[model samples]
Target: MFDLNTLVRPNILTLEPYRCARDDFKVGILLDANENTHGPALSEISETEKFLELNRYPDPHQHELKQQIINFRNSKPNQYSEQPLEIENLCLGVGSDESIDMLLRCCCKPGEDKLLICPPTYGMYNICATINDVEIVRIPLTVPDFQIDSNAILNKITEDPNIKLLYLTSPGNPTAKLINVESIIDLLKRSSSKWNGLIVVDEAYIDFTLPNGSYSQSMSTLVNQFPNLVVLQTLSKSFGLAGIRLGITYTNKKLSKLLNSMKYPYNISSLTSNVALKATTKEGISIMQDYVKKIIEQREIVLNKILDLKYVGKNLGGKDANFILVEILDKFGKPSNEIASKLYNTLAVDNSVVVRFRGNELNCFGGLRISIGTEEENKTLLYKFERVLNELNA
Candidate 1:
């Protein structure tokens, strides 16, 4: 029996979360929350249509928004024959960051419980764990390829039952490698015991993994089979709605209910939901698909251009995401962190073209992460990168 209550912290299990004023009543003067009855002070902004409800609190439920999300994700071709998900299977967060923090808060008992993570992956998992006072057990991914060591992870879980969550970032950050679907399933099957806890696969960049914009490879459909699995995705990357600050987590209804209960009543504002609703529509999805196609094309172009340069070493990882990771080689034909740092600084400060320097990450020594941009932007980045390389090599 995989009991979610057993995995969660004792305090969180019984604690009543803070109820926002909107919970009591949303209409009739709305004096519960104690807002300015006269409305916001900004006269210039009050005239705008969006600010008309400045005095009233946003809807805490966001039922309509979740339905739109369900429509968008379920519209994709599903690999498994499981029943379609309802709004109950989804939880909205400020971003993937909020979801991460909440998971730690609800499960891991600070100073007692711990979480597992594979490095050369997302940094927020570690950061959030630290902030929540939870210990992080680092199991670095295999070098060069940056794949998770599943066997080691299993051993770690067996050895330490205190590990409440395991974070796996697919199409990994800095590395941009996709952990194989089969490998993920294998982990899920092996970790079904009472000792092992939840597995969180952050698919923030999963939309860019395939050129056809098909999410058939996503593990979202397997949530029913493995109730312990949680898939986190965002509209920030592929939908091009980072400014809206919305993210979705697909999991079993039980866990989703727990997350919803613990999360802020009005976690997602009306404005963000309105914008996200439009972005998830049929026409909006079509626009996003078109954008993804162009970005994939640009990624290939940028990859080819970078590989053609003499100073660029072997490209790292599987290149499943919209970004590419490559090593910067020194004059002696060796990966050099010194050269990579210099090139990164020069491109950003002098050429006004910015890319992340991931030389400090494990197996990412002398690595630079370059995101695919518009054609003209890519050209500018390529030109600046080449000029910087030449100057350094000279």
Candidate 2:
């Protein structure tokens, strides 16, 4: 029998999560949770007299928000043409960070069970595992291309039954590479019975891959076909709602229920939920799509400009994300951490422009990860970068 309970930690299986005071009733002149009945002391700024319900607890289920997400996902045209996901297949977290932490807590027993990660990827996975006291197995991606060493990953998982979660960041961090969908499918097929684990694909930058607003590259729709898959997405990157801290996990209904049950009763605040609803509306999506198109265009421009610079070396990995990774080279045209560090510091300190120095990451020595910004911002960055390189060389 295929049982999810067997994979979950014993403590988590019997865990009785905290129920907030607002659970019993939402509408009342409620003195239920010892909350102050008196409204805030601040003066009302709006002439229309709008209240943010600061005195009350937000919805525990976030039914309306999940419905909005479902609508958003279904609206996209995907290669799989999978069935539209209902609320049962969705769960919201503060950000993908929260969801990562939750998954580690629910499935992996502290100090006993393990989570596997392909580094030169998201750092949060490793950090979350450490925080939860869960063991982590590192399988670094193949250098240059930044592709997953599928055979090595499979070998590690097969050898150790303790690994309960495997994290793969699509359009990866720093590298900006997309792991092939066929490779993922092959891994899924091989690990089906041998490994009773979840494959968590973080698609935080998937929006950039949608050049024409198509979902052809997203593995989110694969959740229906692969029961062990959980795709994590966020409003932070594309939708420009980083401050609201809204993240989503799309998975099978059973896992969704468990995640929801384990999460804080009211994980999302009323204000955040309301803003997210507005952002996910038809008009909001159109605006977001237009912004994404502009970003992709800017990314291309930045990539070409960087390549033209004498100090810049190989453009590592696939440039699918809104960022590009380029190595900073010495005068002799070799990757140099010293040169990269100097350039990064000069850009930030002298030029008032900053790009991430990824020189310390594996296989990314002397690398700088530059995010695609607005046209004016990109031009400023390029100009600053050119001046900095000339100064460093001089």
* lDDT scores of the candidates, listed in order: 0.85, 0.85
Clashes of each: 0, 0
Residue-level lDDT tens digits of model 2 in 1-394: 1258798777777777678667766776788777767754557645322466666667888888788888888767356646777888988999999999999988998889999999898889888999999988999999878888989998999899899899999989988988887788788878877888988899999888853445667777678777888899999998999999999999888788888889988789988988899899888989998999999889889999889998898897677888999989998888999999999988999889988899999889999988899999999999989888977887
Model 2: pairs clashing at backbone N, Cα or C within 3 Å = none
Tens-digit per-residue lDDT, 1-394, candidate 1 = 3579788777777777677767765667567777778766665663444453765667777888889877766777346527777889889999898999998998888899999999978889888998999999989998767888989998998888898899999989978998888788888888886455899999999888772345466777677678889999898999999999998888889888888888998788767887888898889989998998999999999998899999998897667888999989999999999999999999989889999999999889899999899999999999889989989999
What's the lDDT for residue 285 in model 2?
88
Which ranges of candidate 2 are over 4 A from the true structure?
Answer: 20-24, 45-49, 211-214
Clashing pairs in 1: none
- 360, model 2: CA deviation in Å? 1.1
Predictions: Cα RMSD each? 2.0, 1.9
